[model samples]
Target: MNKISKRPRTTLEQKIMILNHHHKSQNSQAETVNHFKTKYSISTSSFSEWLKDEQNLRSLYNNSNEFLRNSKRKLNFKYDKINKEMDKIVQSALQENQVINEPMLRQHWCKLVSIYGVQDPKRISSFSHGWLTQFKKRNGISKNKKPIELVENDYDLFDSN
Candidate 1:
């Protein structure tokens, strides 16, 4: 049987230090993972998790700063104008008996993806979901619908016109 080493949980700060040290030493992520596993007596999985946590924290910190900047730039919202526009759209959709379905959204999204020449379905799904959620939130619309499965054929054989 192999040895089961007890790896201690290292702090986020320590993980950052290890990452910076490896970066300064011109080491790749794989090399750093291996090096940390041996030098710090930590498991490879733990090191990988630490790296992911560090990257996520960095992204969140950057996004927070961006949001702050965006908030400062919004001087004229024109709430009434936005409400009128949304009301018009809602009335039009209701008159046409048009309901927004996942397949329709997926089809529309696939057209845009094809126009942009993007082949990654995950990227398309994430972008579509983000836009839909943001639009719903802005219009004060309820988004309690079930999650939709985006199939490979949804993009491959879809034509939105």
Candidate 2:
């Protein structure tokens, strides 16, 4: 004859502490669940269900370590929004300039980057080049802006005008 054994229930605080500890230790959820089951003599599936039921645990599991339960700190940087604003700036510069030539685009791109305080020269060059390439493709404009005869067959696309 087999006897059913009663397992002691883990408190919410204990579960949260276990979750937090495993999270800080950079263990995967599966690993954490397995470790807890072994250490506490509990069932992994039940623990997983409890984590989903608790709002804080749900948030913690979904958001990783960036979330703080008590603090209202904003984690996003203004620079992360640079691309959208820069695209607008580029579009406006193209409209104002009346022609989306490489030199003009580069100038406006650099100016926008300066305004945005993105000071790296290499990054400025890269962003300008990439955006210009996409802009050219989107607008269906040829990089060959000069008179066909005067244009060199292989003029470097991003070379200063």
Candidate 3:
């Protein structure tokens, strides 16, 4: 009896690379399949699936930054509609160059989730710290450099010579 090997999980970067090479490679189809099979341990069927899913991969890559590119798993937003609304609010704030810290994000998220749970009084949901981190990555939100406050009046209190 032969034991079956587990299929290798492809990262987002790996998927994009494979798709790009598939389009640009001068080699024949079989050769391209062989190359991916050898390097990524991905089967021909999986490669075909990636080719079909090229657009989605491209969209994911375009929306994400370098920090999130190499991740092996893609996180799907559980509360899709709620998340979209929250994302819009966050995006507007970011476009205005406003500083959105963790607390502010949490407050918004909590309020959004609460609003969604209105029909079911007992239904409750809250975003986790991990979710917040991933949310920032998904939306390309980052901390701006801290600005120092300037004093209005200087050297007035010091009278010693």
- By TM-score, the best candidate is 3
- Score candidate 2 by TM-score against the native: 0.31
Which lDDT values do the candidates have, in the order given?
0.49, 0.53, 0.66
lDDT by residue (tens digit), candidate 3, 69-152: 788777676677777887787767666655666555655666777777644433244466677677777666655433211122
* Ranking, lDDT, top scorer first: 3, 2, 1
lDDT for each residue of candidate 1 in 1-161, tens digit (9 for 90 to 100): 99987654444444556767766998776778777765455566765665677676445335433332233122233233433443455445445645544454455555455555665657455344555554454433443432322232343432324
Order of candidate numbers by TM-score, starting with the best:
3, 2, 1
Which regions of candidate 3 fall more than 4 Å away from where they truly are? 1-8, 26-29, 114-125, 137-161
When 1 and 2 are scored with TM-score, the better candidate is 2
Number of backbone collisions per candidate: 0, 0, 0
TM-score of candidate 3 relative to the true fold: 0.65
lDDT of 2 by residue, 32-102 (tens): 87777745645667657755766765554444322233222222333456545544644564465444455
Better of 1 and 2 by lDDT: 2
